[model samples]
Target chain A: MTDETMLEEDGHSGGVVKKFLYVNRRAPYGSIYALESLEVVLIGAAFEQDVSLLFLDDGVFQLKKGQDTAMTDMKNFSPTYRALEMYDVEKLYADRESIEQRGLTEDDLIVPVEVLSRDEIKDLMAQQDVVLSF
Target chain B: MKFSVLVNEGPYQHEASDSAYHFTKAALEKGHEIFRVFFYHDGVNNGTRLATPPQDDRNITQRWSALAEQHNLDLVVCVAAAQRRGIIDADEMKRHGKDANNIAPGFRISGLGQLIEAGIQADRLITFGD
Candidate 1:
């Protein structure tokens, strides 16, 4: 293919990546879904698209400190979250209502996320190009 | 708006299913269209044909089926997860030498492409998983 044709297709709609918002609402070790959601988010991030992660309810447990999955014989992915920044996927937010309900302070979490109220979370959900919960 | 829902938790075992249900209902009530409901992981159980709940409590399986029926929504269950969990269609039941097919009528067994397509087509792709 010539450079002219390549350029024409390069600027097409298909070449434009889509933005995805992942809403995580569960504890990490309790089920396989949490890890699976992370894998999906990672895959989307790898595609060079906008990928954002929102933590709500028990999903905040994924980012909680002192996660001991060793007893369950599961891989501790608490550290993988630190790599999210390297992927340029830094739009991490947490529902303040969920954190407060669970008695978790921001210090109790390994990842630093901006806290928002329920209304704010709803607003955030509204603005997203796509929202997937896990 | 077109919406896509990802249900990754079981109806009986987790609150994710109910949450997804309500969210979908609300979305539809607001005049939004649900493009697809992708059931992955344990969410495949939502489409099981053999679940029997108590009379007093709401029949979640029926509720899901009814919701889909009312809205004319596309309910998609992932093939890999469904097969892994022993939820199979007639063809799969025969191939695996099973005695019965456990998949419900309204739900269709499909692949990850449904999810990928939903993400592409819907304005929102909300997930309900724990």
Candidate 2:
């Protein structure tokens, strides 16, 4: 093997871990920021980072069932959101207060998400290495 | 500590913008150095010089200008987003053959790379958006 290849192999003698937390707080399809933030989070997950998604307030609507973007002619990325689990980002959370306020049941969501209390959500935020809220 | 902020919500329209302003103020008070503040999407409107709210309420454009002037803050508006919203700088207006430039002082039009670089260079990247 070439010296460069050998160096490349030995460079990762120890695994490096990256942690990222993305906070979404808007209804899907209303604005581009919500969708763009999701894409960025997925990109982080693809890099083997520890990624967690928190859906707060109106952001919970992003997880709602039966979204139609056909009229807007916008790509329905809500389905792709379910694919986040395959990227090893399974720590999806929905705020209980938000769920209650929005009248959303667990059945109304697309993916399985852990519902968190307000205090629990605060604690979760404190645990993240990087927090990006949109 | 170095910090970067992404303010993607327009002031007066949402509390997110005010929250970001307060957050940055607190960070500065705490001795943290803000590397940049990137306005994207609707946030580009925050950099428009022509915005005139009622005298009773806060003028966000003026506030941002003051903040930028005071701290020498790197206030950036996304060029593409700015143009769509009628917020053009002098150069942009000339380039696009426009009659006017409405971008406020102390803010410059930039690209997504600045946002990425701001995040990479900072110890923390906080976003305030709706």
Candidate 3:
């Protein structure tokens, strides 16, 4: 895309890259929130906004490794988390307290995630232009 | 301030839809610009015209339609979510070979990109859901 094309589109649709934080607070399965949230992340990536994913509570389980769903009907979607890097969704965070409470270490997760304290999470939330919860 | 609202639950089954409606109305009352209301997940159920609640109870869907009509508000239902939940407009009903369309007036079925656009265009993006 050239500057001429950008200016043409900007005449009607003016947009600036905004910080969009998608806060996930649920387990991966038993509900559709986890899956649908991922779908939104993939779709929203097309907009080229600054995006981040924060996992707290049961949402941390979404990144849990060695997920075996062969017996159940649910698909093992943990692999998709690894693919998020391809979409430039590189910023992933988790609450340290929540992870510790669940007795899961950073190594237990499938992907590399920055662990932050509760206060740090609050500050991070304040920094976001939009905080979408699921 | 310009605001965009995201409703992610059903009309009567959850408070999310009602809360979103009231918040939008309140914002409009205070002379704020509502950029759009993007309904997702079960929230698409709020756009159905087939809902007939008890006469004494508040008509959640109608309230939204009236508010949109009054303010010329853009009430966008996520096309993917709506299709999955059986909330179809005329275009979708025709394309999918459905018997009828149940989308209420003032509500349009569109893509999820509209929600992202709302987030970009609006000064604030608020999500009212579980």
Candidate 4:
């Protein structure tokens, strides 16, 4: 379908704002995927799209507090998670199983996030127009 | 059908790029319209023209360029991801005061908005990654 027709069919011919869900499955610092995904989320917030972030697997560690990269020579960007609220991108979901597996509680994170079960997260993922994983 | 593809891995190192390429080609062969291909993370490396693979093997960058040229596809490399990985276009090179640029043909540098836009505009947004 053409772009115009797709927008028109959605009844938002003026502009279609899609639901974008970013799935974070990697740990921070080990690779650049986690940090780069955040960059996309931050930039995507500017578009005024319906955006949600999901933390699964080792991605739960990204929200953990007191992340020190002093010896790694990489800038610790964990503080940026707090600023997500200012961007109006507040829907942060952390998998309960992942947290429990890693022996972490909600109190350990730098910012507050909704802890959901795998099934609940699956339902949320189904509702998204786009699911981008990193 | 309209399709939007996302590639998250670099060339040679992973099969994500190759898989995305084949999927896109197959979709096009079946008369599907490609809304855009957003290269994120190491996938941005696919947009560099400096890759010099051996002559015997498939040149992934050239394959993408050729497909884009044949189909007039929109290949977008995320600016934020590209900058961190040293993949810059002429404008970004000037803005960042870099010595040169290596962005491949048929690929443009843009923000994450293009990706969101693609998801909105396309009927399907398929991602190939680890």
* Residue-by-residue lDDT tens digits, candidate 2, A8-101: 2121212444456788888887677677676456444434556789999899999998999899998788887788878788899999999999
Q: Which sections of candidate 3 miss by over 4 Å?
A: A1-15
Error of 2 at A88 (Å): 7.8
- Runs with alpha carbons beyond 4 Å of true place in candidate 2: A1-18, A29-33, A39-50, A70-77, A80-91, A95-123, B12-31, B52-59, B66-70, B79-84, B89-101, B111-120, B123-130
Distance (Å) between predicted and true CA of B107, model 1?
7.9
User: Which lDDT tens digits does candidate 4 get at residues B1-130?
Assistant: 9999999899999999999999999999999999999998889999999999999999999999999999999999987778778998998888878999999999998767677778878999998886
List where candidate 4 sits over 4 angstroms from the true fold.
Answer: A1-14
lDDT of each: 0.78, 0.78, 0.89, 0.87
For model 1 chain B, the run of ten residues with the poorest summed lDDT: B109-118
DockQ of each: 0.13, 0.11, 0.41, 0.36
lDDT of 3 by residue, A45-127 (tens): 77789999999999999999999988888878889999999989999999999999999999999999999999999999999
Q: Candidate 1's residue-wise lDDT over B1-130, tens digit each?
A: 8889989888877888989999999999999999999898888999887888888887777887888888888998877668778788887787678998888867888765567567877766777774
Question: If the candidates were sorted by their lDDT against the true structure, best first, what order would they fall in?
Answer: 3, 4, 1, 2
In candidate 2, position A34 carries an lDDT of: 75
Alpha carbon lDDT of residue B16, candidate 3? 85
Worst 10 residues of 4 chain A by lDDT: A1-10
TM-scores of all candidate predictions against the true structure: 0.59, 0.62, 0.91, 0.91
In angstroms, the error of model 1 at B12 is 8.4
